[model samples]
Target: MKRSRNEHNSSQEEQEFLRESKLVARSPQHKEKVKQPEPSMDEIKQMLRDLKKDLHEDMAQIKREIQNDIREMREDIKDTKKELQKNREEMKSMAKEITQMKEEWTREKEELHNKIKEVEDKMERMEKQKIRNNLTITGLPTNTDNEDTLEEALEKMFQTELLLKTKIRRAQKIGQDRCIVEMVEWNDKIKILQGKAKLKGKDIFIDSELTRNEQKIQKNIRDIAREEKKKGAIVKVGYQKLEVNGKKMKWDHRSQKLTEANKLKN
Candidate 1:
């Protein structure tokens, strides 16, 4: 039985060996894949150097761009400053021109004003001379429309009321109760004015023919005389003058009022 068991074990081992051989025969052969070799130290250093060179080039380009931007900003600031300075200069010049023009205009205006005043004074003198030998008669009746009749009537008045012989150059009715008479002689007008008080009871009046400006001044003088008379102070109104309390008053063209004659002596 031991011999049979050994033979039986040998047959099982032989069958297992045959099965392994069949499996090895039927399977495909696999070749070994070759692997890449690891890098040496020198190769690794070279790669690192190339990467560093590329990074440095990029950094250099970025720095150059930053410098260009800074230079452009500086140029812009310089241009702005130059423009501001130019504006300031132009404004100053304009201000100077305006001041000069204003001064010249003021001077011209003053000269024009003085010239107008001078012309007015000259015209006033001419007007006063034109009416030097004229007289204005008031309180006459409008009895006739004839110029000869009016002249005859005024001649009769001079003969009867004033008791003065006067040659009437021209006599015309100016209004219902007024007439302006031009005398051939200036002394005749003076005589008629001097003898005007004689016709006070007859309701006849005589006065010198005055310019409009003189008439206004005479009116103001009479007003001042009336006020002084009311105040119990002696006042006399004559032609274009006023006398208050025995002091002569002159008309001030500048002030347009009566002022003491002595006050203007200074």
Candidate 2:
């Protein structure tokens, strides 16, 4: 009787295990676990690929922006170079214009100088011509009986001393002891000037009348000429010139020095 009861207990345990197994297989929670699964390697790889693509797009956009900036900078540098080149060219042109202006000013100055020289020379010649027929006599006795006219007295004096026929255009007492005589004839003026040696013993001096400027120049030349004359040079002075042993000297308006008469520059 104990053996039969033990077999019956063993069969009952097996039947209970089969019933639990069937219930687990048929449950909704167990079916849902069976349907879902962990991700595969291929799906993970596709997500990684999408992330890489986005990163590459961002890098490409940044590269394009940098390239545009570089292009703009190069354009600005090119514009600056052109502006500098234009400025340099303008400077060169202005310098050339300035040089031309200087040359033009120099030429005008020289022309003006020449014109002034010409005018001075013409004036000098005209001034000398005016005094050519005139004579100045110094050391004449003024205390003597006064004649009716100075022209008569001069004519009488020349006739008595040198037997010269005197024909005077005008005559006057210039100072306390001097006389001025103007002759009508140039030849007579020359003759009287040359014949002054005949009146040397009378303590009188004779000279040609000159312009004030020429007289001053003559005085300077006479001073130098006198010194040279004492040293054995044949020196003589005219109104505006001097001759020392055939070498001529004249006053130069430009140089302001007594230079050689013939060799002065125009």
Candidate 3:
């Protein structure tokens, strides 16, 4: 009976230990679950290949886009260079035009200066020539009968000194009362003689060269008159033929041979 009780106690102790181990394993917090193993090496390699192919496609598309962008940039650069060249040519043309205009303006300015100088010189010459130093007297009474009356009238009209030189006589007759008077200066005589008409009643005669010649002789007579004691000496005056504006007239002498001789003498 004692041996059997000892065997029974040992079996009961073994059962109790097994029951406590089962309770401990059944508690949720203390349980440890087993994990499945990873996939095989071939499966992992197939996945890696798929990912690599997608990455290659994406890289190729990015490279294509980069190439297109580079091509566009190059074209833009080329167009910009062409535009710059065109602008440079335009600037050169404008510069040439400006230079030409400047040269033309310089020429015009010089020409204008020359024209002004010429005008100034012409004005100076005209001013010098404008000095009026002579006088003219005309229209003495024809029937006044004496040289003294004519000289007095002319002296009063011109307000100048007058000298009576000679009394003109007919060729075969005695002295005619017609005479000539002279001023001291040629310019004074020219002023009085040029373009002057003399009126003797109804006849108006243009002052002839005969009148001028007579005036010259009159000047000589006045010089001779100063040395002569006789105041009434007859003075012989020379004759002349005058051609004016293609018209001819005989003056002073009566003989045609004497007139021809006078012309030859002149």
Candidate 4:
């Protein structure tokens, strides 16, 4: 086949390159490759030492970085431990303060209760003093439908039954059958109470008027007196006390019952 002009030029250029390469290979001006001599033991040792030094330096750098990281971690752990210990100490102090507050609250509560009780006793004493000259008449029949009032009826009964002319300051019915009578003179009240024995066989009765506190105390004493009498002991119920075998017993406000008069202080 006939080659094109450009193809013919490319084939000629390849042949020229081959001929030039052959000449350059055979010429003395182009020096032959020298044979490399084997390394001596000293040189080989030096190379190994250089390589080891480089590797050791790299390894030392890595070890230092790791040690620094470990130190930082230890510091963090120490800091965390210190924070935890501080929290524990704070909690202990708060617990101690709470305990102290609780004890103080309890003591103050008891003192407040005692002060309130003292106030109540003082008020009760003043109330009892006001009604000292009053008397209570039980089992005295009152006719509400009759024209005669309770006061007129009581005055007539006192004059007829006790043979005494006592001037009453006030006369009022308290409950269903009881009459509270306030006498003008303290001596008149004393005489009326002494004359109560005359109406013993009849259904009438007379007794001193008592305050609410005194009534409660009298009730407690009567209960104790009844129990003592059941045990064959000599027992008597007084104003607000009980006499058991000649031993005087008073009402204890704290215990809310009768206690021996001597032991009441204790």
Candidate 5:
């Protein structure tokens, strides 16, 4: 009975040891299998914060791109505005030039109109003077000194029976040295005088016929006057004579008197 009791006790001890070994083996396996506690709210918040930081970084990058695009747009707008201003300035200049041209054209048109009117008036004056009794006499010496000399020369050249009438003084401010010879003609002696006069002299020039029929005689006279002016010669239109105190003084008489006085004083 004592051996059985000791053996039973030993058996109980072996069972206890086997239970402990099994418990030890099961503890490592259970520890490996055991689930850890869920993460704390703080840790989840940290992970979310990291994710938000990445998202914010992405958003910041997008914002930077948008800002650069906006800057480019602003630059484009500035350039467009500058171009527009330049174009406007050019247009203004062109418009000014056009206006100046128009004004110049208007002035020129007025000047042309005035010139045309002057020409028309001159033509009308010429047309009205054509119907007068015109006389033409030739064969007077080109250098005849006075109206009497010219008439005498014409009389000698044209052996016409004509009585001398009063001299008609019709001179011009400018023209050839010419005078109208007044005479009463028997038959057509005046016609003979007109047909036979030849102008001849040294240092004298005269035209056989008046330039243009008597219609443009005034214009011809003006032309002749202009020519005489260039030669420093004065043209006289009426019975003009050198005078002292308005009395007609003969050139020869004055010179002869001056010579006689000088001779006596000497």
Candidate 6:
């Protein structure tokens, strides 16, 4: 039995050896994958340099894009500046045109004002011509109590003092002391004015009825005449003449005179 047991043991060992040998057989397809060695320092540096070059190219591209954006912005700014300059020029032109129009309007307004003043002066002169047949008697005591009695008194005074065959158009008491008499005919106005010397020294006188402006103008003329009288010049304040020392001096306006070496018509 022991010998059988040893033989059995030997057979089992041999079978086990054979199985191990079969399991451990070297197959050509089952080669071990060899891990590559760690890179050397030079190779590592080359890889890092390649990575740096790529990074630099990307950064350069970004920089070029930024520069293009900046250039576009500058062009936009230039366009905006041009538009602003154009607007400024337009505003200046508009302002100049407005100033010119204002000046023209001012001139036209002044011309219109002057024309209106001239027309008013002409109308006043025409009005004075209409009332040329009227005379204002000074120092004539009017009948203030009654209108008919006043007219009768004026009629009687005219019959006595003025020897004129004239009819009274209207005779009214203007103020408390004076009377305005309107004659019927132009001849009557002449006769009454010519016969004023007859009523002289009786605290009365006759004067042609003139406008207030004309009265002021006559007063100015009389003032000039008074000044000439002081210079021993025989000055008379006529309708439009200043007879200064026997020379008919034309009164233009104010104290200015257009003088001529002409004698006064008798």
For lDDT, the strongest prediction is 4
Q: What are the lDDT scores of the predictions, listed in order?
A: 0.86, 0.83, 0.54, 0.87, 0.53, 0.79
* Greater-TM-score candidate between 4 and 5: 4
**Pairs with backbone N, CA or C atoms under 3 Å apart (clashes), candidate 6:** none
Q: What lDDT score is found at residue 91 in candidate 2?
A: 98
Error of 5 at 171 (Å): 27
Query: Taking the tens digit of each residue's C-alpha lDDT, what string does model 4 give over 118-202?
Result: 9998998888677877999989877663333776888898899999998878888777788788888888889999998999888
User: Could you tell which candidate, 5 or 6, scores higher by TM-score?
Assistant: 6
Per-residue lDDT of model 3, residues 38-78, tens digit only:
98999899999999999999999999999999999999999
- Stretches of model 5 off by over 4 angstroms after superposition: 1-43, 132-266
Clashing pairs in 5: 138-197, 139-197, 139-198, 174-225
Name the runs in model 3 displaced over 4 angstroms.
Answer: 1-36, 131-266
lDDT of 6: 0.79
CA-RMSD of model 5: 22.2
User: Which pairs clash (backbone N, Cα, C closer than 3 Å) in model 2?
Assistant: none
Model 2 lDDT tens row, 18-55: 99889989886766544668778998898899999999
Residue pair clashes in candidate 1? none
- Candidate 4 achieves a global lDDT of 0.87
Worst 10 residues of 6 by lDDT: 257-266
- Count the clashes in each prediction: 0, 0, 1, 0, 4, 0
Q: Please report the TM-score between candidate 2 and the true structure.
A: 0.58
